[model samples]
Target: MRNFIFILTKEIRSYFYSPVAFVVITIFSVLIGYYFYNIFAAFSTISFQAQTDPMVASQYGVLNVTEFVIRPFFGVVSIVMLIMLPMLTMRSFAEEKKTGTIELLLTYPVKDLELVLGKFAGCMGIFAIMLSLSVPCLLLVAFFGDPEWGVIVTGYGGLFLMGGAFISLGLFMSSLTENQIIAAVLSFASLMVLYMVGSSSGFVGEKMGQFLEYVSILSHFETFARGVLDTSDITYYLLFAVFFLFLSMHSLESKRWRA
Candidate 1:
């Protein structure tokens, strides 16, 4: 436990000391804030039209702020995470290897799983920081409209899970190479496939289609976004993260043997 904490603290400090985390955080905040503003502006326009026209009013009925703003906000954040997490995690082990510090790290008394968990936790902490910067957007929506807080909370939960899964995959990818670019690119490609494959399920046969959708990370995330906390979705995210973490540990362990 002490060793894990030591490793975790080391990883966290490394992230904060580096410029990559700050750059990614800035870009994410700007992009998400812009997206939220666009959504709010469109919603305001629709709301104005609804006031003047009976048809438009009927179509809109009562504006569900939760549906209009919060859901889309969460969705866009998830998409932003798809891009940002790879950058955040691309250096988990890649940098260590690139600097020839992996040998020094392995010389420590820490176990491979402990090191993996510590790195995963550190990446997760950075992810949480990046995600928190969007709180103002949510607060802005809530200030003007009555959104369902419960749904918003659940949506964030889903986003966090999705981010963790992405980080885990990125860590595994990082472990595979000393080159950060290759690790980032590989992580992005793997995440893209995991995210988009569910859409293709429609073109396949019924059974295969169901299986494909079930395997998709987006499929599970969508359910959580919709405020349905099914055990299956939670299980999928947990297992996905665990599987990759295990793979990362195995990767480091293999390297130890080679060394």
Candidate 2:
């Protein structure tokens, strides 16, 4: 546990020591803020129209803040995360390998699982910070409109889990390459595939479609976006993260054997 904390802190510090953390955070904040402004603006316009015109209200039905604003905001945030998280994880193991520090890191009195967990935790810490950017947006919505707190809570929870899954896969990809760019590219490509895999489900047969939908990371998230906290979705994300983290540990183990 102590070693895990040490490694976790060290990884976090390393992120700050470089420009990567700052750059990613700045870009993330700008992107999320832009989306939030646009989404909220549209929602506000529609809401005003509905309130002023009974006809508009009747035509559009009830204007749900959760459905019109918060949900779509979270969805856009997820897409932004898909694009930006790779930059965070690209250097995790890749930089170590590139600088020949993997040997020194391995010699430390830490188990492979601990090392992996510590790194995962560190990345998650940064991810949590990134996700916090949404809080003010949510608060703004709450102040101006009645939004479903349950959906907001589950939406962030789902994002955190999805981010863990992305980071774990990015860690595995980083372990496979010494070049950070390659690691980032690999992570992006893999995540894109997982995100879009469900789209192909419609073209396939029923069984295959079911399988594809189940495999898609986005599909599981949709339930959370809708405020449906299904155990199956939670389990899928947990298993997704664990599977990749296990692979990352295995990758390190292989490197240890080779060393």
Every model's TM-score: 0.97, 0.97
Compute the lDDT for candidate 1: 0.90
Residue 107 of model 2: what lDDT? Answer: 90
Clashes of 1: 0
Candidate 2 lDDT over 1-259, as tens digits, reads 9999999999999999998889998899999999999989988888889989999899879788899998888899899999999999999999999999988989988899999999999999999988897799899999988999999989989999999999999999998999999999999999999989999999899999999999998888888899989999999999999999999999899965755
Tens digit per residue, CA lDDT, model 1, 180-222: 9999999999999988889999999999999999888877887
RMSD of each: 1.3, 1.2
Candidate 2 Cα outliers beyond 4 Å, as residue runs? none
Q: Pick the candidate with the highest lDDT.
A: 2
Model 2, TM vs. native: 0.97
